[model samples]
Target: MKLACIENIRRQKQHVERYKRQLARHRSGEDISLKSQKTFRKPKQEKHLKSFQVYKDVLFDEFLDKSKKLQKLTNQILKVLSQVWESPK
Candidate 1:
């Protein structure tokens, strides 16, 4: 269970990192696709960008909360296991 939680946290971290990279790229205009002949570039909207930023912030906050919970659970489990192991059979 601890390993699974650790793996989940790692995956979430990677996902958030990937999202951040994509957002940065989009912000820098690196995500614009060029048309063959007719070029139609959509103007960046501040509203949409602000919403995306907010979404990313929310995701990050959720990730942090889950990780903290997992850490607390892990510590509790370790403490219990250590106590059990040290007791006489």
Candidate 2:
């Protein structure tokens, strides 16, 4: 009987400690949520904007490269046409 009583007390103490820890966690979670409410969207939008700008820059660079290649191909074709015109068949 004495041993059972001692075990019950130990279990009660553990339960109380667990309850305190849970309450502490809940309080900290509230603080974090409050802080996030004020600052979350700004950082998220900034990150999205930054990524979008980078994507636009990449697309522009690709367009420039393709245009340059097309110009080179056009020049080569013009050169070939000029040669053919100058030479007798």
Candidate 3:
């Protein structure tokens, strides 16, 4: 029983020493722990609807132009191949 009581006192003393050190650090303004810091998140602003629509339309027109050019080139190549195939070997 005495051994158990001594062990409890030792544990309590260690805890007290840890608490005192933390208190002293706090009083000196040196306790910079992540768990004690406050974090703030800035709010996000919405995009301008008209400007976004104009940008999207411009990008889409560019994409369509590129696709049309690619298709025309492919068709021309196919036509050339077909003529070569029809001609005598």
Candidate 4:
């Protein structure tokens, strides 16, 4: 029973020592060095082509499709005019 009491006192002393060390660290501001909130990622690089060229190509394709549609509409209007009204040469 006496040995058990001694062991308990020893364990309590160790716990107090640990708690004091932790307190000292907190007072010294050494325990606040936590992981950073912001993470760094590698910047992506274009491997195949330049960004401007890619965008220009996309815009050119769009313009070409629009021009084709306008040409078809104009042709239909001219055909209708030719059939309904005679054109003077």
Q: Which stretches of candidate 1 lie over 4 Å from their true place?
A: 1-58
Which stretches of candidate 3 lie above 4 Å from their native place?
32-89
CA lDDT, every model vs. true structure = 0.82, 0.83, 0.81, 0.76
Worst 10 residues of 3 by lDDT: 38-47
Q: After superposition, how far is residue 24 of candidate 4 from its true place, in Å?
A: 0.1
Encode model 4's per-residue lDDT on 21-77: one tens digit a residue. 767877987753233213434345643347756876677778999999999999999
Q: Which pairs clash in the backbone of model 4?
A: none
Candidate 3, after superposition: displacement of residue 62 in Å? 29
Top lDDT prediction, candidate number = 2
Model 3 TM-score (2 dp): 0.36
Error of 2 at 70 (Å): 0.3
Q: Rank the candidates by lDDT, best first.
A: 2, 1, 3, 4
Model 4: which ten-residue window has the lowest total lDDT?
32-41
Q: Candidate 1 at 60: error in angstroms?
A: 0.6
Angstrom error at residue 54, model 1: 14
Q: What is the lDDT of residue 20 in candidate 1?
A: 85
TM-score of each: 0.36, 0.35, 0.36, 0.35
lDDT, residue 47, model 1: 70
